[model samples]
Each structure stands twice: as C-alpha cells, then as structure tokens.
Target: MPLSTLNKEQLSAATAPIGNNLIIASAGTGKTSTIVGRIAHLLQTGIEPSKILLLTFTNKAAGEMLERVGRYFPAVVVNKIESGTFHAVSYRWLKQINKNVTLKQPTELKTLFRSIYEKRQFKRLNHDVEAFSSTYLYEQYNLYQNASLDGFDIWFIDKYPDHKPLIDIYMNIIDEYEDTKDRFGFVSFNDLLIKMRQSLLENRREMQEVLVDEYQDTNTLQSALIDSIQSNSLFCVGDYDQSIYAFNGANIQNIATFGKRYNDATVFTLSKNYRSTASILSLANRVIERNERIYPKKLEVTRVSKNYPPKLLIYKELFDQYQAIARNIKNSYTPSNDIAVIFRNNASADGVEASLRELGINCKRKGGNSFFEAKEVKFLLDVLSLIVNPKDMMAFIHIFEYGKGIGTAVAKEMFECFIHFGEGHLFTGMLSPRVFNLPKLNPTKNMQLGLFDDDTQIGSISRFAHLKLSEQIKSNPILKHPKLTDDGLIFFKNFYDFLKSIKNVKQPQTMIIKLINTPLYEGIVEMLSNQRAKLKSGEIDPDKK
Candidate 1:
C-alpha cells in the first residue's frame, strides 16, 4: 500500500509525525488501507521493524496486516515487527522471565475453581454458599478482573449488595486459586494482561511505537494495560459508533477520551466510505446521530453513482420474516455470487437456514459449528442408534465412553465381550450374565451377586430377573468388566431400564418431557439438567456446546 494511493485525509494521518495519533475511522472507510499506508510510511522513514509494534484484537488481524506489509517489504524485515494480540504478546514477555509460563482457558479454570470450592465446608457459613452455583461465582470472579480494577469485594458490594455476605468466602477462594496459579506458573487471559502491566511498570521502553486496533471495544482493564506500555508513540484507530462489546466489558469512553488522555494526540477522520452507498450511509448517520456524541464524526460516500435506497420490511411472525427473505433471495440470487443471510443469534440462523432449504436453495454456514455437530447431540444420537439396533458396536462404544474409566480401547474390548456372550446380539448377552460362570472371572462373586447359570444361553438368559435395575447392574457381567470402574457406569444401567420400557413401543421421542416420565431415563434427564445449570452468563445451549 503506497502513501500516494491513500486519500488526502488518510495520507495526512499516515505520514503525520507519530507522537499520539488517533484515527477516527468509520465503518468500511478503508481503515485497513490507512493502517497499511501508515506502516509503509513508517518503514520509509527508516524506523527499524523491531521498534514498531502492532496490537490487534485477534492474532488473525495482525497476521493479515503483516502479510499485506510483506508485499511492500522484504519477508525478513516484515516478520521482525512485533505483532500479536495483547494476550499473545504478553505471554511471550512473561515467558521470557518464567520458562514454565502456561496459559489456561476459561473452561479449564472454571473446573479447577469448582474442585477447590467443593472441598470447603461452606455448609457451616451463615450465608448459603450453595445458593450460588460455582459457574456463576467463577464468571463473577472473571468479570471483576476483566471489567474493572477496583477491589472485587468493593465492586461486588456496590453492585450486588445482597451477595455481600458470601463475598468474603468467594474472595478467599479466588485468592487461593490465584496463589495456586502463581505457584504453578499458570495464567489466564486476564492474568496475562494484569501481570504484563505490572512488568511494564518496572521496565524501560522496548518498542518505540505501539499501534492499537479496535480501541473503542476495549474495557477499562485493557485500556489501563495499553496505557502502561512504555512506548514513545501511540497510534489508535477506532470508531466509537462501531463499539459493540459492552456486554463483555468494553468501555466506549476508551476511544472517546483518547485525545484528552494524550493531550498531544492528533485526530484524523477516515470519512470516505468504500463499502456502502450514500443512501445507506445517510440512513446510518441519521440513526446513530441520535445518540450522544463524545467525538463528532460522519461518513462520506466515495462513489458518485446512484444506488438503491435501503428498504425496511415488517413481518407479523418470525417464520414469515425468514420466508420472505428466502423468497426474495431465491429470485435475485446469482450462482456466481453467494448471498449472505446474517442473523444475530443461532436460533434465528436456524429459521433462515430451514426456510432457504425449503425453497431449494443451497447454503453453507461459516461461523460456528452446526447444531447437530454438538457433542451432547452426537451422544444422544448414538443412544438412539443403539435403541434401534442393539448390535450397533459403534454406538455401544461411543455410549460406553461416558462410563467411568472406560476409553475407546476399553470400550471396544467390552463390546467384543458382550457380543461374544450374547452369542450374536448385545441385549441377549446383557440379559443373560451367567456366561461369566465359565470362569475366567470370579464364580463365587457371581453367586453372591445372584447371577447363576441360565436354563439356556440361547434365548431369555437368566440374570437378576428378581432384582431391580440397580441390582442387575451390580451383577451384570458386562458392567463388571475387570477394566471398568464402579461409579460412572451407573448411568448406563439407567439407560438399560429405559430400553426395557420402550422395547415394545413403535414410536419413541427424545423429548425431555417423555424422558423425565420414565423411572430409568429420568436420571439421565436430571444429570443433563444439572449440567445445563452450569452455563455461564449470556451462554445459550449452542454456545455452551
């Protein structure tokens, strides 16, 4: 990207003396092109690649910028420029001092917190600690660190005074967790930011210039982390109107006050809109202008050609909305150019996808995994597969994975043993456990378990006919596998009871209501419901999976 190729505003901003520069770039205004031009101008001024640092929200953004820069400079020179997200760069900095530094994801940290929490004698506390789920408390601990620098106790007390009673215990638990992390050289995403700032406070400048992307969508904690950088120059590009992460702790004021924070900051507006027509920008401006303006800005169209005005359509039902969209797209869509159907939530996406399919239009998704691809869904499907045909070895092995201490290899071994005992079908072998009397296993224990030699192993084998499912599980030859454990396998026993109840029913449903009515499958439903109760804030079933 050459400086001459940039618009006048972009050129001025890119080549301006770099002290404290803030580029107020509106959406689709070639912000990336300005950044590219800026990079070229910096290199043209003979600045060393290592002295320039580019910080992006995602590693992919940094990689894209570098790849574009590489086209203008030698690969060796381009690669040397420090480029990465805050977490990525901080990890490298922290790793230099502690070779054992390790990063843990939110899921892993939550599990760790729960384990430590369960060991405490919270029952004795006047405040019912059990009232708050471990997941909710863990999310709050993270929320405090990510959103604010205030003391967790103060923050919790000020916002959720009712939770004040249990705050001390949570604070202690979190303190213990943090100490454990430090002792083990473990750091979460927020920890990397927190520790890196502390490190920078004690160090001299390493990079002379630091560039921050998506400044408007950064939280107070992140903004503080950026301010702690010991760089001589700061280049931040953001559009306050584009800020959309408030729910995740993003502060709109970070960008709004950038000029005031850096008194010498020079502001430039990238107003030329390359992506939208004048009609769209006009409506956009009208809608956003109604909001309070911390820093005034507007979008200007680049193209002089006339374009279609934006249309607003209303529908009475959600399904009707999707149907209308699908009908319109079906008539105008070109095979060479794909049409996009953007939805805010997965549930809306599902509706649009179904409508499109009904109209015989082929579409593919790009964001998250499909609904059927979830682990729980696949597990349920496996169970359904097993119910349809007990001889399904694959389904058997998959379901067996839920059994405590049973891996794929062990499950496979169990499957073979079941098939061998059943003589052909898995249910036949399970219904009759007397084959264990042949004795590679304990015969006296089988007698103790009330599992005896059947009248015949061919059909309707004898095994705990007089006992309940729980008793049968204890005596079942398959469940008593030498390699299997005694616990987690209990769920499988419940599933067996389910299979027996529905053995004669032609029509079966996976509905929770139906499952809860069964004495056997009700346990599975309850366990799944408990798992769902652990969902984090703003997490839906799709995102949870």
Candidate 2:
C-alpha cells in the first residue's frame, strides 16, 4: 500500500501524472499489485474516489483490486470508486437514469436468432454452391457485432464471398431479429456497450479516470465504448501475448493503438517476473518472440534460477501424452498430489484422470466438465438407459427426439407405438434374435415380426427373434411407423448401425469415441462446433431495472 513497496517502474507509473496511461504487463509480473498501487496513489494525490472507475473483464477481478484498495482506504471510499466489468458498469449507469434495459440471457437471444432463421425456409439453396448453416450465420453475426464498426453484410460477404447469393436472406432475417429486439427493448451484453457509448456521447458522464485490466482482450466496440466515456485520463493494463479471446472478437491492436489514440498517453512496462524462474521465462520469451510484436517487451526474472529446464514433450497420441505425464508424476520424488498437470480444455482432463488412476494414483479433479455431463457421453448414456429400462420416459424422449424432426410430441407418439409393438417393454419384439439357419423374413413387410415376438408362448423359438441393431434396421417393425419422417428414419438407421457396432463394447472409453462418430452425433457437431460455454453473470440475465 506504500509507494516504497512498488518496484521502481511500478512506483513511477503509479505516481506519474495521469492524462492517459498504458501499462504493458506480462504474466505473473504483479500487474494486480501495480493497479492497486496506482489506485492508492490516486487517492493519496486527492483524486475523488467517486470519479475513479475500475473496469475488469470479470467482477471477481474488480472486487479483488478494490479489496486491496480497501486495505488503504475506508469502505465508503472504496465503494464510491465504482468498479465492475464493462457490461456491469454500463448497465448500472443506464439503469441509474431509468432506462428500460431488458437484459436477456445469451441463450434466449440465440434462440430468438434461431427462430427467425428457421422462418426463412432455407432447406436448400443453390445446387452449385454450399450454403452456410444456421449456427454458422449466428456465429458470424456475433463476430461482426464484437469485431468492428463495419456493416455485418459487408463483413459477411467480404469474408465469405461464396455466400454472396445468400446474403440478402440472412441480412433480412437479422433486420427482423433486430426489429423484434428494438420493439421489446431486449438488450444483450454487446447492446449494453453500444447503448452506453451512444448515451455518453449525447450526455457525458462525470468520471475523472478510467482504469481497465486485460485491455488487450477488448475488441473494437469495447475500445470505442471506453473512449465514449470522454474521460481524459485512461489507465489500461494488458499483455498482447496473453490475449486469447480472438474467437469472440478480441482485438490485440486495442493495446497497441492505445498510445496512438491518446497522443499524450504515458506508456509503462511491468516486465519483472516474480512467479517463474529464469528458465521458464526464457522458454516463454523464445516461443512468444517468434510472433510479430505489436509492443516490444522483454521479461526479467526475479528468481535467479530453476533446478529444471522446462521440457517440451510431444506424443503421437493423447493416451501416450497422459500416460507419460502420469508416470512422470507417480515416479517423482515429490508426492503425487504436489505435482499438477494443467490442460487447455476440460475434455482433455478425462484421459489424464483415467491414466493417473491406472497407476494407482488417487487424485481429485477441481474445475472441469466430468465425462458424464458431456453431450455425446450423455446421449450414449441415454441410449443405454432406454435399453435397460424401456419405460424410462426421459431416456425414451432423449433417444427418440435426437433424430431430426422428432420433437417431444412426435417422440411421445413414437413411444406409444414402440410400447404397443414391444408389448409394454421396449425392444421385446424388435430385438428378437435372428436364427442363423432359418430362412429370413421379407424386409418390406415388418408385421411378420409379430409372429416371432418373445412373448409368443404358443410357438417354438422363432428364427427372427432377438434382432441385433443392424438387423433391426431392416426388419424392425418400429421402422415402419407412420410418425417417423424420412429424416427421422435415416437418423435412426445410422443410430442403430452405430449402436450395433458398440453394443458389445466393454470399455466405456471406446464407446465414447464411437458415439461422437455416429451420423446423428456428427450432424449435430457439424452444425454446432463450439459447445455451449458456461455463461457468466454478465452473459445471463443481467439486472433489468
């Protein structure tokens, strides 16, 4: 909290005259500490607490910075500083003036986009060219809003020239969707910034200084919104190498252009590494240095040395990768619990957990999606569940409705027919075994399957009883049901073939791999590549007051 506690550069930046300032901070270089130091210096220099605005990508970050600031200041002083995420602070400013901001969840907005998309009846387009799928369009629309100030139509056509023929329909659908949102006063997180920027431009706010963290991840719109506050003093801290949100339209240039945008901006570098040894920093610098540098920076390690130089390991298979890591930790002199392996995605954790347990390592995973909650895994589980207990309506619904065109109503109808055919138990009549030596039944007329039903006590074991999934595709009476459309039939046939392939599988890991390859699964995956991410409070229904 004291000025002397900060390093020489940190102290200089914290106490420097603030017209506009950019702090280029690399990973684990005590950026948070410096931000807190800056806040303390502002307070010590008699800047109004009410006029200081702290913005972060997450409220948790803001809370953390303010909590540190609170160590040097009173509750009233810290609370009056107005710290939060861009969306959160913008929503607050808009709500304070009694705007009718109806913030809806991203899923709701996406659903609305989908409904409007379906109304245009784009089952097929040109015979010569491939058309963009609905989900792809939605993704593009979101990208356009976040990435730039240019027209969505222009951006879409420029990026995807093949989609030129389909642009009008897509734009029209978007226009209608926007009109609906306008009519209902529906607002998304992006909308909050746009509205806030517009409002501030018309009537400026009274903030003396704005401080932002992770400024490199901000896209063009966010940068524009930040400038619209009209505060002469700006403090932004970010590292370009740390930028990871490009998929969601993060612009690294925001950090690069900051000094140019504000000609009087003072630029400072926080290059001291307190967390990692020199070896790690050397490897990181080597890797990151290969990329084009927007802002030149070199990290200096506070830790003089490390016992081990970081090794870059490459394996042909994931099993080998996990197996190697697990073995390394298990055989180490240190306790297994003391060693940790971090991965980029939650899906990778599954294999690591399995490999560790194989070596008799007892470990508890902290924050990642478990195998069961996965969509593909859950779908396979539903199939197994329906097979075991035919009357499980939830499992039945999940399995039947998975095929295209089979909604809950049609699935309910399909269930009724299945129950009637199965004689109260699912697959009783359908899964009947095929007697290898006997003559096969006509593939077209499936009602003959009734003669071989397992419930028939009057006859000897029929040749057609106990059908495998592959056999059932052609001979199963369920295939002849009226409610099943052509698309539904195709989905089930593919589903059955996949099921039959994995029906005898003992290893769950193998089955899961096959589950993702199923035509039904592949279609869904192709349509929607990015799995639904866990929504933050900013993305979900924000306060509509």
Candidate 3:
C-alpha cells in the first residue's frame, strides 16, 4: 500500500500540537519516511521553513531527511530550514551568535607527553606506556570536552581521584585554548552546542517552533538548547526502545518524561510493525518483553510464510555460541541472506567477523569507519603512512597537522622516528631509535607507493602483527622469562595462532568466532555484560521493543 493510504493518526504524534508532542516510532516502521513526510506536510500547510526548526542527532540523518523532502516538494526552500545533527546545527548558530568563542580542536586532546612512556602514543594509552598513564590525562581533558558539550557540572570532576589533578590543570589550559580559538575564529563540535544554547536563550522571542528527531538521544545540553528557545510549539519523535546512545550521554529521561514535563503534552504510540514477518515480530516482541514499562504495542504481520519460528539462541559461552551460529551459515549461506548480528557495542563485531571469515564467507561490517577511525589508531597510521612514502604528503603531515597543541617536542620525536625508519621496518624496532632528528627531515621526494586499503579489515592485520610480536618474544629464552606477567602478550600470541589457523576463512560469522577468543574479544564481552547490568539496574529497560 502507498504511504499516503496510511492515516495521519498512524503517523508521528508530533503532527498534533497539544502544546508539546511526543512520538514513539517502532523499529523498521518507516520512521525516516514518516518524519520526512511530516516535514513536507507541515510545509504544504504554510509553515515557514525558517520558523520550523527540524533537529536531528546525526548529519547523515539530516541530509537523508532533506533529500527525502526535496523529492516530495521540489519547490520548497530548505536552505533556511534548520536541519542537521544537534552539534552541526548548534555549531552554525553558535558561530553566528558567539563570534568570539574560539574552540579547541581534537588534536589538542591527542598531544604527546613523554615524561614516562617511551613507546608509541596509542599503545601507551592502551597498555602502560607512559610513566603516568595518559589515559588518565587524556580522560581529564575529555572531561572538559564532555562537560562543555553536555554541561556536566564543573564539580563533577572531584568525584574521581585520578581526574582531580587534570581538572585543576584544565582550568588553566581551557582558558588558553578558548582564547586561541577565539583569536583564530575556530570552533569544535562541542563549542557548537554550547554556543547554540546561549544563542537560543538570548533570542528566545525569535524562536517559533522546534522539531526534534530521535529525541531519545538528546543529552541534557541538547534538550536545554531546545527548551531555552522557548518555542511556542515543540514536536519530538522517537521510541524509548531505540535509545541506543547512552555511551554518548543521551538521557532516556528526556523521552520518558515528556508528558509529565509538558503539561499539554500528548503522547502518541505507533503500534504497527510494518516491516517484519509475524514470526519475526513475535520473536522480537517476546525477547523484549523482559524489559518493563514499554508502551504496549502488538505487531500483526500481514504476510504469511512457512519459515521456521524466529530463532533465538542462548549460549553458556560466547565461543560456543559463535561456533553454533557459524556451522549453520556455512552449509549454504548467500550474501543476500539479510543476517544482521546487532550487538550492543562495535567491539562485539570482532568475534562475529572472525567466525565468518573462518568459514570463507563474505561479510561486511554494518557500520561506518568509527571502529578504525579512533584517535589512537589514526595517529599511529598517520606516522606509518609518512614513513612508507614521504611523498604521500596527505598522510605525512596529518599526524600533527590538525588540532591544537600537538606539535610539542614529544610530537616531533614521534615524527622523527617515522622518518628514520623506512616504511617496511618493524614498529617495535623503529620506535627503539636512540635519537630522533626532527629538523633534518625532508619531504622533497616525489615517490609514490600507490594506494592502500586502510579499511576496518586493516585492524585484523594489526592484530596479526601484534600476535607475531608475541611469538617472536616467546622464542627468545631471555625475553620469555617468568618475570613477564603481562597477559596482553600471551593473549595476542594465542590470538595470532587462532588467526593463522583460520587464515582462509571468509565469512563474518566464522571470523567472529576466532576474533572473540582474542583479548579484545573479552573486553567487548565485558562491555556487553555491563550494558546488560545497567539494563537490569533500572538505568535502562530493554523492553521498549
């Protein structure tokens, strides 16, 4: 059936303005289509695009919404419509409102200090590389970032003993960073929301309407930004079950308490599950029934099929679980099988990847480059790309090129090490250089090593390299002495052994199984366990299915 056949009452509850509006959209229920259509409907009804601000949680989502609306209403002007991730929109507003507000670039937070760690910066942070672990120092700076973005009270730092000193030091550096950014007219993602909230408060009368998408992901500051605008009408769309951004500080309470907070607020529930088979929907519903206080919605599937009842498996050990799943898929799995292994965390994908790869199955990670694009890994690769071919100027200068306060003596040492060792040299051997001459480095070479795939799969390569290092260490009697109590070395060695055994496996499920046995796999398991605990502890309810 065409979307137009769907009744308005079947749409986002935001269409009805009872003062404040809350929409609970279910999974695979055309949430984006409904949102875009709503925007088009609002426009057709004569709401000025400029007056109706549509806020989303991610830029990609905003872009998609804009494109969708354009398809339906070609003549509508969208340039003035406020549509973007909360940070992107906020940044644009903040740039206009606080012209003098300078921002610290992420590079400032990634600077190197060699007081203790003589190893690579990324490894130092993950393992014990520095005399004083930089994780504490890095997290100290991160607190300021988080506070600036989310407005956590300044006193919150006192709760952590290790962070207190960094907080004290931050009081001085933050001022300097802000001053420098202001002088240069720069802004960071955090600076955007901080400024937007300030702008909305100062110009409250000018604000007319605010429409928020994925309202469940709103943090304290984001919610405040909308509230401070004092808009006459507030419209929000999201389901509590889909609030998956707790790690980024999203407040579930924002969605959970809409009715109580807004006296005239009207709560609307979209009870239809328009995208799943009856069996599939039933399984999902049953699985989520364990969570409490979810809006009561039952799905009735329109289509009937003889497929086996939706399969849900519980395993005592994660390894055994992967083995069982892998065996089933290997016999006759196709790429278009539409198997989605949704995990609570990105790291959880590792084990699944290994298991699938072991079975020679073709599997692509579902998400974007977030896993491989972490600050630590990127910095390490930046250095490697430089040494591999200085002519690869893009990679050569990216290490210390962006961000503030990263060009310190320690940064220079890292750069020099990269220059001294040619591209093919071992990371451990190259980093052991006695002297790093930063000034003598020259980039006049015009050689090119061609292009390389720096995708998420490269992480598997890095893991393999670490595993090889562990084996080489074990072979040396002196280095294998009992004094070495670090389990990291042993785990990586075993991980490499496992990887070698399934080197030809090509399926995601098989690769996942092998990857899970790695030390990193355990870390991911711990994270999942923690999330489960939080769900059980009243912090989150998994039942909003």
Candidate 4:
C-alpha cells in the first residue's frame, strides 16, 4: 500500500503532475491500485478531499476503490472524496439540485415504449416490436442525444441503410417516449448525465481534480459531463486496445485522442502484466496489434509462464464441439468456478449448459435473462403491483392475458372499456353491467368441467366456478358461459382473490412469497422441469440440432 511498494511505472503514473494526465492502464496492470494511489497522493499534497472526484463505470468498482482507499487513508479524507458510478454521481448531484426529481427504471421505460408501439400503427416489419424495442434501441437513442444529432432518421439512414425502414418508426417511438417521460416527470439513466451537465453549467461548481476510471468505455454524454464539472485538472485511466464496448456507444477515441484533446496532458502507460502468463500476454498483444488505430504499448508479463501450450480443437459439427469441450472439462478435473466456457451470445450458452448437464455437471450461466425480466417473474410482479395499485393499467393489461384465449386484442379492448367507464379497478369494472354484457352459461361445457387433464387449466376453472359471476354475467354475456374458457375465468377469479387477500398487506416480500406459493408458480416450475427433461432427452438439442 506504500508509495515505494508500487512498480516504477505505476508509481510514476500515480504521482504524476496532476494537470490533464492520461494513464494508459492495460488490463490487470494494477489499474485500481493506481487510481487509489493517485487519490492518496492528491490528499497527501494538501488538496481538499471534497474537491476531488473519482468516477467509475460501475458501483462495484467504486465500492472496491472506496474500500481500498479507506484502508490506506483516514476516514476524513476517504469520506470527503466523492466516488461512485457516473450515473450515481449524476443522480446525487441532480437530487441535491432538485429533491423531487425521479428516475424511471429501465423496465418501466421499456414497457412504456412497448405500449406505445402496440397502440400506434406503422409499417410492418419482420421483427416483433417487443423484440425490436430493447436496450439496443435505448442505447441508440442515448448515442444520438449525446452526439447532439439534429435528425436521427438521416443519421441512421446514412449509417445503416438496411435499417432505414425502421428509422421513421423509431423516430415516432422516440417522440412518444419523450412526451410520456415529460408528462410523468420522469428522467432516464441517460438523462441523469444530461441533467447533471445542465445543472453544473448553471451552478458552475468545479472540482479541484477529476479522476475517471475506464475512460475508454465512456460515451460522448459522459465525457461532456466530465468536462462540465472538471476544473481542467483531469486524470483519466484507460486502454484503447481494451475498448470493446463500441456496440454500447463507447468511443474508443476518447482514450485514443485524450492527449490531443488536452494538449498539455502527460500520458503514462502501465504495461506490466500481473494477471496472465507470458504466453497468454504474447497472444493478447499479437491479436490487439492488428487494430488499425491504437495507442502502442508492449505488455511484459511479470508472472512466470506455466509452459503449457494452449490447445485448439476442430470439430466436424456443433455436437462434436460440445462433446469435445465437455470431455476436456471432465478430464481436466477443473472446478466449475475456475472454469469458464464463453460463447458469442446467449443462444450459444444453451448448448453448453445442456452438454454440461448431460455430463452430470451443474453450471450456472452468467448474464442471461435478469430475474425481473423473466416471463414468470414479470407476470407475478405485475399481479402484485396491480393489487397494490389498481390504477396501473399496464399491470392490469399484462395480467389479463395470462391464460390462453384472452389474446392481446381482447385485453386491449377490455382495458379501453375500463378507462372509458372511468372505473376504479379492473375487477370492479369487470363486474359492472354497463361494461360487460354476459351471456348464459353453456351446460355442455359446464358439465365437462373436470374432464380437462391439465392441472393448470383445471385449477383455474375450479377457481372461476367458485367465484360469484352471476352479476358480471348478467351485465356482459362475454363474461358468462364457455366464451370465457374455464381456464381463463378461473385464472382471473383466483388472481382477483389473491389481489384482495394482499390488498392490506404493505410488505412487498410477504406479498411476493404468498404469490409464489400460488398455482401460477407451480405451473411455471412444472413447465421448466418438462423443458429440462426434453432437453436432456435430446428432443430439444442444446446444439440446436
């Protein structure tokens, strides 16, 4: 932790003259340590900790830096040194300026975009709107906003002519998205940086020194925010060769052109590799040197090489590849934690996972569907949200079509009707005679109630049959008889009852637990179990056979 303990390169970079310095921190060359040491030096040099800002790409990284800084420095200095992700710091500043400011979660924004996409008519495309309106679209929007593009349509058309058809639709979506956010007084993650930049410009509160980690990963907006707040004493650490997030709007040029941007900038390179062996470092350097534009730096491995030659295997087919990987994993006696099988995408993970499972090995997939984004999880969360806030029309619409037969069109119409009548809740609206005109029950279908084999369907029907639907049926015939299938009616009634049961329960965890114990959870579990069974049996090949 001492200044003398650092290698010559690290020590030099960490204690360099602080005006507009750029530290080229190659991967695993003590980047975090350098940042920590730099901050320590700043505090030691009679600089006010309050005036120094350390910005990281993730909260985890910031936490690690803070933890290390606290260990090496006094609490007085560590506490005063503001450190956090760019978004977190921005949000804090924005909140300080306006206490009432609120941010919309990514999921909520996506839902809003999806709802808008569904409501509007546009030229049909091969892609599903739900699939098309994802994080990628949001990233594109952020890029355009950051670059200050006047017209995204022209920019996108010029850049990607094949996607020109989607340009107009995306523009419309963006318009609706902006209007909705304005109405709700909501700001997005990207908006945090933009708003923070505006606030800093108006307030003109400059930091004594600003330190940025992973500077290569920064987009234009983040760079702008940094420029707005920094007092020209900037220390940025990044490796241009390691800038692999271009798809996410990261500009490698930020690192490549840093010296040019700040003419007086002192550039330092930390090329001592402490993580990988000499052989691995050689391969990495060879591969990265192929890049047309890069800051040249030779990495020298400090660690002793194992002298084991890397193996490359060729397979005739996808299954053969999976089998070979599985065999090697088994033969090597590698613990699952120490072993990593990476692929091009999530689709490739399925086959590897299947192969591992077939070999009686359990492997956890990292970075697949987020817990909140999973279909079953989302459905339950929606149901719980609807129970707590019945006016959440999106939640109501989502849950309305949980069971088969109640398609999107039907659900949309029902929601429109509820809104037209100015109803209090969906259940209350369904029971209204003015809203739904129910018909007589079909005797044949009623008699065939228990004939269904599916437990899920039978359970739903049983719940619906027990509900007092006479009042609803009298008002709307569509709500009566077999038109609303036993399965559909049952799910609706049970869900309504579940909502009512948790109506007074304020604890979200309690509600979630209760919801998870319901038949819906069981159904999801059973479905997944069946899918796994099929996968192992080779009915659904992991290799996409």
In order, the Cα lDDT scores of the candidates are 0.73, 0.74, 0.56, 0.71
Q: Estimate, for each residue in 1-545, the C-alpha lDDT of model 1 and write its tens digit.
A: 47778889989888889699999998898888788888888899988989998989999999998888888899999988988998898898889877777787675467557644543445544454344667888888788887888898898778777776676666766776787577656689999989888888888556778888888888888888878887888888899888999888898988888878886889888888999888999999998899788777878888777798999899999999999999998888466146777798989999998998999988886689678766556567777777776755556666665555665545655666666676766776666654653223212222222223332132222433444456666566664454454443555566566666665666646433344575444444445555665566633454333
- Model 3 gets an lDDT of 0.56
Point to the candidate with the largest TM-score.
4
Provide TM-scores for the models: 0.69, 0.67, 0.58, 0.74
Ranking of all predicted structures according to lDDT, beginning with the best and ending with the worst: 2, 1, 4, 3
Candidate 1 ranges with C-alpha deviation above 4 Å: 120-131, 370-545
Comparison by TM-score, 1 against 4, better one: 4
lDDT per residue as tens, model 2, 124-208: 3433555566677877888888898989989888898887777777777788668767865778888888888889999988788
Give candidate 4 regions above 4 Å deviation. Answer: 99-102, 123-150, 160-170, 333-337, 346-350, 353-374, 387-397, 400-545
**Model 4: per-residue lDDT, tens digit, 282-350?**
888888888775566889889875765566788879887887788778788667789999898766778
User: Each candidate: how many clashes?
Assistant: 1, 9, 29, 10
Task: Flag regions of model 2 displaced more than 4 Å.
Answer: 98-100, 124-128, 304-306, 335-337, 368-545
- Superposition error at 145 for model 4 (Å): 4.2
* TM-score result, candidate 2: 0.67
lDDT score at residue 452, model 2, on the 0-100 scale: 20
